[model samples]
Target: MLRTILRREHKNRWERRAALVPESIAQLAAQKIPVAVEPCSIRAFPDEAYKAQGAELHNDLENFQLVLGIKEPPVASIAPQQVHLCFSHTIKGQPYNMGLLQKFIDQRATLIDYEPIVDERGVRTIAFGRFAGIAGAIDSFFVLGQKWLKMGKPTAYARIKQTKDYPSLSEIKSELAQLRVTNDKPLHVLIVGTGNVGKGAKEVCQWLGLPEVAIDEVLAQKAPKSSWFSVASARHLHERIGGGAFDYQEYLQLGKAQYRSIFDRLLGQFELLIQTPYWTDKYPAHLDIARMNENMQALPLVVGDISCDVNGSLKCTKKISTIDEPAYSYFVENDGIQDGIHADGISVMAIDNLPCELPVDASRHFSAILTRYVPELVKMDLNQTLTHSGLGKELQRAVIVYNGTVMPEFTYLQHYLDRHKLTKPSEAS
Candidate 1:
């Protein structure tokens, strides 16, 4: 039997989600797989719940060979030769997590990143993206209400509560269903992307009884009596630098090399912008500081950056907001960031871990999918080479580091490691 332990999340106080729920533990127990759980005071599922499912509550995870967590673990906690599964967040050569990656390499550990765990079609099999979108939209509305109130123009948004304040998703939907926006001034919302995140945001919009309109309708027509939303794809936001027809496939192959953002042209049309697209530095930003400064009067009153990629898609998202302090103002005139909604500048809500606000729901959804793969994950022998290992294609492709060495497919990260000068412990000595 493989020894596995569910580690407690320590990223922030708001991160109370569990990678494995009590039901998952019970399922593992039926298979005679004994599981351990670290005691966490604030976890959505308490220690007693895990204990009831025959899980041993232990502070030390040294005895456990396989450890599972939702987020990246701290560098000081990693042990030598352990098999760890988590969202490493270093695949993109993220400067912040390079030290954590270096620790894993030095310890000769096997790392399985959840971000790349995909099916044959390259679609992610397990993720909290949907919940992120759900909570993001909820919080975005709350921010808008507060922003409008601060600006001395209170609206129906003020009635919406923060996601954490709601007990369940049903309650949130009920509240939204009853909401009535009778303000004479029209409210227009624009959503970006069409993936799970976008769907989640759209679900919230539907609950609020907001009619979905086309981008052309949004740009050409006057704002309707009631609030309405429009969704935009990559083609709608970006165009060829020389003004040719937009070819999405070609744009994907050659990112910023040929594309320039046309999103600014539609800036004056919407009062709120909910961003949910997957973005990187290679893509043109939806709104840059220079463009924002130039079009301050046309800028949206609120920007809900659900995809919270720092300095990535929307350059105004200079930093990740916390659940405790979820809203901030971005002043384009001075390129300054001020906490909370101010009369000047746009109110920005960019919580990186939005799902954390609804821990119970997010954990339940995530654990259900993760439980299906736990058995196969624990059975794999980490001593063997990745090629020889019996892991299925999904798991195999998800391994970013095996036995302290960067996997061949992820060797590009070596360049970042070298640039950061993250030498091994022995090398440093």
Candidate 2:
């Protein structure tokens, strides 16, 4: 029988999600595939749930050649030549996880990262992005309300609950339904990106009865004051430096086009900005710090850096905040950071793990997509090259490392590995 194992997530205590739900285990078992699950005390699903679904409870993983997890595994626990699947978070050669990447390479393990499982068009096939957007938007509003309260300007959002405080998205929308534009000035909201994250934010805005507006209308001061939101795509946020029109294809090529942000002009009009676009060094910063310093009053009162690429896309996002301590004040003048949004700076919410706040719903959504590929995973022959193997093409594309070597698609990470001295672990005496 094809044997597989599901390991417990020890990397993050707050991460209670599982890559495969117990129902998925039952489906795999019905196909004659044997599955085992490590005991987890804190996972959203209890250990008995897996047992009820025909999964064997066993800590012994030596017999299982394939292991699945939601997050990265501990370096010491990985067995050589095992097929490990999880969110390695190493595609970027992230400094913090270089050691973990090195351990995978040294152990001759095969790693299939979840984040890179994209379609031919590069859209992620599976992710927690939707929930992240939902939680992020909710948290952004909470921060905005708290900041207003601190300024002695109470708003309708003061009665709204934090993202984690809500039992479900339905309850969240229910509370938002109660929110009315009671303030003299209608709160203007700007949402960047039209992907899943942006859609989530837009849903909340619409639930609150906020009408959508155009950039030109907002700039012309014709935008509605009490309850309105404006959505901007890549073209609206950036343009060529020399008054040239923004070309999507040209922008994809990093050095071919010189682009600068036009976000500053739109900043002053909106009370809040929810940024959800994927950002890299190639793109211009959404909110240029130097430009913001020149016109502090023009900036939005609150910025929800939902993408949360610290110091990558959003210049003001210098730190990765936690769910417990989600917001901070980013001072543009001296580039200083404070605990809350005081009079000295603008409020920023850049929580890295937004989906954790809505784990139950997120896990169900994630597992549904994941279960579809299990048949291919259980029957795949590891003897053949991954490219030639029966592993689904989607899974094949996501394999960053195989048998102690980086794949051609991920060769770019080699420079990072070399820079970080990712040498093989020394043989113990």
Candidate 3:
């Protein structure tokens, strides 16, 4: 696969939103791989989670090379996907923190290196899913099909066994009803940040019994003036001393000289929110957070800063399910051994060794790209000789709940039988 490289003004901004990433870089350059577009903006690195797509690949770095970008392709400040392959990128290379910028809120996790593919694939395949931190660079290649394949196949890889358990709540309600969100209603969420993604979206909404709502300063100080709303990270819109007159535990230590208008007045009560990558750039104080909520027909939940504002927004054309980073699979890093065949002969590589790369081929390429976005096992018709796609140990079909709901939305809060205001004491008065 010779060259590859591309970005060409992010391929004319996803070809004016018709997106195919320039027909999949002209079918990966017909197949030989020589591709090379580069006007630039394929992001994910050091700290560039869309700094206007790294200032537009820093004024178009020379137009082309051997690139095939989605994340890592920018270089000049020092980026060869960050030298000799840091080989982590399962989805995360930027966003240690953002705008209201909590300065990496404590940042960690970046210690990859197994040693130049440990001599010829001793182990390595990291096909990412869940927390690869901040992912986004997938191409899931194919001139073929993807409308949830049934038509001769473009996606159906398998290997999910070490004992399986993924997408079952009717495969995450048929992948959240293939993300239609035009009007299922229930998506008002607002979480913000502090850690463990606001306790995992309050434990995936008390494990999906759903309903937690919290953006009150008495409803953002009775927002009216013909509400379409605009807190813009509260740079200065003081409605007679603004919402709940400061004291949410003393403004959580007055960080960012006051939570950039308290997370823009708690995301102006919700056009569908959920932040925390420390809230990037801290904004005019809102630099396009959750589609800046003036109500583009509602329905948003830009969680954990992963979908990078719905795939680097110019303004939501739709179709966004980003987690980031994609290269199929490759790694063996941590440059240690190599001069011991005597020095070059013994060669097994890696001193830090994050499990000799390839933990079951990076857990079966993150369980076949997270079971192709978990359509809750589309009612499994398996047994036709079973391939499901690749690396295998299990998944002939297993996932315990995304619909019947269980496995891990925070274990449905130990079956809470609703207590607290169990009344009585007030009746005595």
Best by lDDT: 1
Which runs in model 1 stand beyond 4 Å of their true positions? 182-185, 219-225, 422-429
Deviation in angstroms for 294 in model 2? Answer: 1.4
TM-score of model 3 (CA atoms): 0.23
Candidate 3 per-residue lDDT, tens place, 1-429, comes to 112233332322211111113333333334434333334333211113222222222333333212222222222222221111122222222231011011111121111121112213332332222222111100110100121132332222111110012223233323323433222333334444434334533443333333443334325555432212121212222221344464444444453454433333443344323333332232223323343345333333222232333322212211222112111111112212222111111111111111111123323333343223222222222222223422132232211111122224223322321121232245336
TM-score of each: 0.94, 0.93, 0.23
Q: Any runs in candidate 2 off by more than 4 Å, and if so which?
A: 181-185, 219-221, 255-257, 341-344, 422-429
- Among all windows of ten consecutive residues in candidate 2, which has the lowest summed lDDT? 420-429
Indicate which candidate wins on TM-score. Answer: 1
Each prediction's number of clashing residue pairs: 0, 2, 47
Superior candidate under TM-score, 2 versus 3: 2
lDDT of 1 by residue, 1-429 (tens): 458899999998989999999998998889877779999999989999999988999888777788999999878888888888999899889877888888889999888999999998889999998898889998998898888888898778889999999988989999998886534346788989888899899899888888888886655655464668888888887889888899999999889999988887788888888999888888888788888888889999898999888887788888988899998998888888999878778889999989998899899899989888888888887767887776888999999888899888999998999867755454558
The lDDT ranking, best first, is 1, 2, 3
Q: Which model, 1 or 3, shows the larger TM-score?
A: 1
Root-mean-square deviation of candidate 3:
26.4
Candidate rank order under TM-score:
1, 2, 3
User: Against the true structure, candidate 3 has what lDDT?
Assistant: 0.26
Tens-digit lDDT string for candidate 2 (1-429): 347899888866778888888888888778777678999998888999999998888887666778888888888777787778899989878866777787878988788899989888988989998888888988998898888888888878777677888888788888788776544347889999999999888888887777888876875668865678988888876778787777888887852248877677676788888999887777787676778887788888888999898886677888888887889999888887888666447899999888888877888888889877777777767677887768777888999888777889999987888767744343221
